[model samples]
Target: MTHKIAILGASGYTGAELVRLIATHPSMEIVALAANSKAGMAYEDVFPHLRHLALPDLVKIEEIDFDNVDLVFCGLPHATSQSVIKALPKSVKVVDLSADFRLRDPEEYVKWYGGQHDALECQAEAVYGLTEFYRDDIKNARLVAGTGCNAATGQYALRPLIEAGVIDLDQIILDLKCAVSGAGRSLKENLLHAELSEGYHPYAIGGTHRHLGEFDQEFSAIAGRPVKVQFTPHLVPANRGILATVYVQGDAQAIYDTLQKTYADETFIQVLPFGKVPSTRHVRGSNFCHIGVSGDRIEGRAIVTAALDNLTKGSSGQALQNANLMLGEEENAGLMLAPCFP
Candidate 1:
């Protein structure tokens, strides 16, 4: 069964990524491309790397006939997606790659995103699309919310440990480094070649980062109490991937064993050999997340590191995984491509 797909925000990084992955998918058809600013331009013209594939010309959101689209991948920015998805026909299943529907509590959305959710009804029905942890819910959801790239990376490193009760919840810390592409295809003075190429620095320090809302909501639910981790994100000069180094008070071997045993049967998650670490370069351009654990020289501490392409496993690929479930297709369909290596 072929599913007709529409990609909103088609000019952005994650949108192009969705196109790249779906280009090779046998059962997914790209029926529409929507990018308000780039509307009426050929999709290949916006992303020349996709020139070899046949795709529709980009159009404004209003131009799309949702009735023909079996699935819509909403890659629009945070505040914009809520109103857009709420207006779409309810019959079209949606996979939203935005923060708008990720937090279940609309009040939490306001606290973190600084606005009341315009689509409260839609948000209520939206399933958190973490894929590994929320698979069953996604399978039955009409709208699935893709997790933040940093949030996804941090969770891959820490969720298993939290669930197993092997780690001290009070002392958790997550330090993350992400590629510039995760910032999106937008132009920022700081993202310029001269400004970013040679140096790397941290932003969203001191718990001000918005992804903390996701960490707070997800972790708190997992522990049945408020679990807040100190999180700091750094923007490194790269095109893809995120590496989260999580510090927790736990037995290193136990942390490694829990992760290994939990993800051993999972298709896209790989728990690296104990004491070895994973690198972002290894998982670039793929939907795979590689996690590793090492003992701290200081007693009662362990370092858990996870790496994945922030654009793929963290966003577009994750949306695809959820869409597969929504459409009754194989969960890994169109997402089994291996990582790109130099």
Candidate 2:
């Protein structure tokens, strides 16, 4: 049975990505596309690359009939989804690709997002959208909160080790490099071609990046204690990936075994051979996450690196994965495309 899908924030980067992937999905069909700012315009006008596919014209959210949509992919900005999703029909499953409902605690939501959540009831029932770890919950959820791209990259590297107690929780450190598109389609001085093409620098140093809230929430929960990792994100000139090099104190071989075993059955996550590091180029434009592990010359240190397309595996692709489970379809349906390689 084909499920009807509607995409909110269809003019943005993740929105276009959802359209790109779902266009080939056998069990999913795009029925509506909403982009309030670009309402009454053609979707191809907003994203020229997608001009080849026939799609619904961009419309205001209020104009779409939710009762007809089987699932809704909320690609709207943070805080925007809370109110918009609150008004949607509860029968339609939702996968939110924003930071709004990711944090379970309302206070943490306010602390990081600087506003109280408007839809407390929905937030309460929302399952976290880390597909591999929360598959069962996602299958039964009406709402799933998609993780932050940076947060997702970091977690893919650390969650297994943390769960197996193979690393020092207190000493974990994540150094991440993110592509420019992760900043969203909006224009900013820092993201312009002139300022970003030749250089890269860290921005959220000293544990201040908003994704830390996610690390704190997820990591702490797994360790059964407060686990805070020093995280720093740098913006690179590339357009579509995230590479996180995590430093941890653990048995390198053990860490590798744990990750290999943990993801042995996952369709999208690939654990590269030992000592073989992953590159963003390999996983670009695909729903795949490649992870590599190596030991440092020093006695007790290990480096774990993970690479994925920030827009695909990290956001829209992930949203679609959870949507598959929620709708009782094949988990890997429409998601098995191989990575784009040069």
TM-scores of the candidates are 0.99, 0.99
Against the unseen true structure, what C-alpha lDDT does each candidate score? 0.93, 0.94
Model 1, range 115-167, lDDT digits (tens) per residue? 88899999989899999999999999999999999999999888878889999
| lDDT digits (tens) for residues 1-342 of candidate 2 | 989999999999999999999987998889999999999999888888999999999999999998899999999998889999999988889999999899999999888888889999999999999999999999999999999999999999999999999999999989999999999998799888999999999998797889999999999999999999999999999999999999999999999999999999888999999999999999998999999999999989999999999999999999999999999988877778788878
Q: What's model 1's overall lDDT? A: 0.93
Candidate 2 Cα RMSD (Å): 0.8
Task: Report the poorest 10 consecutive residues by lDDT, candidate 2.
Answer: 332-341
Consecutive 10-residue window with the lowest summed lDDT within model 1: 155-164
For model 1, the superposed segments whose C-alpha errors exceed 4 Å read: none
Best by lDDT: 2
